[model samples]
Target: MKILIIEDEKDMLQNMQDTLVKQGYIVESASDLDSAISKVGVYDYDCILLDINLPDGSGMDILNFLKKNDKTEGVIIVSARNSLDDRIRGLNTGADDYIAKPFHMAELNARVKALLRRKNFEGSDLLKIGNLCIDSEKHTSTTQHGEMELNRKEFDILTYLATNQDRLVSKSALAEHVWGDHIDQADNFEFIYSQIKNLRKKLKEVKADIEIKAVYGIGYKLTLS
Candidate 1:
């Protein structure tokens, strides 16, 4: 999953990014409102951690922008304001959840997971397709045959492809989803192709029920075999 942390506090932002990275999420961050707005406008995210008090504008405006644009990314407001009106206002503004500062990272991670489940997996930790089961919480994929050992990018690629199973996913879309802002640094998709090749071999070894089929002019698709 990809997360955008919109926080002005340098230490706090770094801490949150680092924590999520360790949890196996692709993370990007911005410290001010403009940067935050730009990111939310362009990129797709599984979840967004927003700070209400930004350097230039209120995070409420960010929430409003997301709603106005009809973006469906799950948002959790992380703010210092603990007032009833603030909480009510945030929830009413279409935020999925709210967390106050001085919060534990573990609890924050838990809330993020819960929101992702509700948004992406229909409130389940396990995302299953055919015989393959992906424990998004544990970041593990397995089949009836056994566990499928995969690197971070490989697992992320499989998850992304599986999420859009049977649909032809463009290479740009897959690269952006898996690498976040870092994808801009790559000149071509050889890196992505390499990961998909490895994932396909692993699936074959486990005798999995799905296959990653490449489309010559476009990209790849995951189909049940």
Candidate 2:
């Protein structure tokens, strides 16, 4: 999954990013409100870790922007302000969870995983589609044939598609979600096609009951075979 960290403290930002990356999530970050808005404007994320205080502006605007735009990304406020009023304001504004500063990375990771499960997997770590079972927390998938072998990108792609099963996913959105900030450096979406092709081959090998079907010039969708 992809995560966006909106924070001002350089040390805390780096710590959060590193911790989540170690947990096998594609992580991106912005240190201030402007950069945070810019990122949220472009890409889609599974979860967002937001700090209400920023060097330039309030992070509340970002939350409002997300709500106004109807973006589906789960948001967790990670602010230093732990006041009852502040927590209430954040939740009322559209945050899914809240955690104060000076927190354990483990707890933060747990919150992230919980939010992702609720938002994407129907409050469970396992996404069961046909004979395929994907454990989001473990970052692994199994079929009736047993566990399937997939590289990082392939797994990310499969997970994203599975979450949006039966829906057509645009190539650009897939690239942005899976590759995060790095997709800006690419000139085309050839890499997405390549990854999908390889994932299809692996799915076929395992005799998985799911199929990723391409829509020619559009993108792809995952459906039960």
Candidate 3:
């Protein structure tokens, strides 16, 4: 998943990035409101961690902007303002969850996962398609026959496919979701093709009946036998 951390504290920003990256998430950081606004406009993130206090402006402004734009990105307010009213205000302004300052990293991670489940998977951690099972929390995939470990990109591709199972997902959509803003500079989508190939191979090896079908002029779709 992709995440945006809008925090002014350099140390806190790095900590959040490190924690999320270790869990196989793509993370971007912005220390002020301007940068956060710019990044939000150009990039797509599954979730955003916003601090209520920033050097330039209140993080609430960013949340309000996102609401006004009709952006459906998940949002969590992480701030030192532990007052009940502050938390209430954040939620009322469109924040999905609130995390007070001095919180444990584990809790933060849990909250993020919860928010993602609520937004994308109907609050389920395990995604099932026929005999194949994907555990979003463990980042693992298994079939009735056996289980196989997937690399980061492969896992990402599989997850994206599973989420949109039975629907045609365009190559450009995969490129944008997987590679994020970096896809603009890429020369070709060979890497995406390779990832899909590897993912299909792994599933087949495990005797999984799931199939990824190419759409020729379009993209691909995940179909179950």
Candidate 4:
């Protein structure tokens, strides 16, 4: 999944980004409110790790703006404030969860997973389609015939396909979801084609009966036939 970390503390922001990256998430960060707001407006993220105290504005202000813009992205408040009112205010302001400062990174990771599950997978870890099985927590995909390990991007593509099974997902959508802010650096979308090719090949080798069909100029679709 893609995540945005809005934190002013350089060390904290880097640590959180690195941890989430190792956990197989695409992460982008901003240290101030304006940059944070710009990211929230332009991109789609599965979740946002928002700090209440930013360099220029309150984290709650960013939250309010996101809410006002009708963005449904999951948000978790990571703040130093441990007051009851602060926690209550964050939740009331549309944060999915709140983690106070001096928190365990492991626990924060757990909350992120839980929030993603609630938002995307109906609070489940396993994503299944036909004979294929995906363990979101472990970031693994398997078939009844055998097990197949996937690279990070391949796993992300498959997971996305499983989530939107039977729907046509455009190339731009896939690119945005997988690479997030780095898509602009690419000269072309040939990389997307390559990832899909690899994912399809692996599934086929395992005798999995899933199909990823090209929608010609648009994109692709995962069909169970």
lDDT of 1 by residue, 1-225 (tens): 899999999999988998999888989998999999899888889899999999899999999999999999899999999898999999999899999998999999999999989887889988888889988877889998999998888888998888888999999889999988778678888888899889999998888899999998689999999
The sequence of per-residue lDDT tens digits that candidate 2 reaches over residues 1-225 is: 899999889999999999999988899999989989999988888899999999998888988999999998899999999999989999999999999988999999999999999998999989999999998877788888878888888989999999899999998889888888788788889989899989988888888999999999899999999
lDDT, model 1, position 103: 97
Better of 2 and 3 by TM-score: 2
Worst 10 residues of 4 by lDDT: 179-188
Taking the candidates one at a time, how many backbone clashes does each contain?
Answer: 0, 0, 0, 0
lDDT of 4 by residue, 1-225 (tens): 999999999999888988898887999999999999888888888999999998898999988998899998999999999899999999999999999998888988999999999887889998788898888888888887888878888989988877889999988878989989879667778999999999888999898888899998899899895
How do all models score by TM-score? Answer: 0.94, 0.96, 0.91, 0.93
TM-score between candidate 4 and the true structure: 0.93
lDDT (CA) per prediction = 0.91, 0.91, 0.89, 0.89
Give the runs in model 2 whose Cα sits over 4 Å from its true position: none
User: Tens-digit lDDT track for model 3 on 26-58?
Assistant: 787899999999988877789999999999999
The full ranking of all candidates by lDDT, starting with the best, is 2, 1, 4, 3
Off by over 4 Å in 3: none
> Which ten contiguous residues of candidate 3 have the minimum total lDDT?
175-184
Superposed by TM-score, candidate 2 places the C-alpha of residue 22 at a distance from the truth, in angstroms, of 1.0
Ranked candidates, highest TM-score first: 2, 1, 4, 3
lDDT of 3 at 33: 94
Alpha-carbon deviation at 171 in model 1, angstroms: 1.1
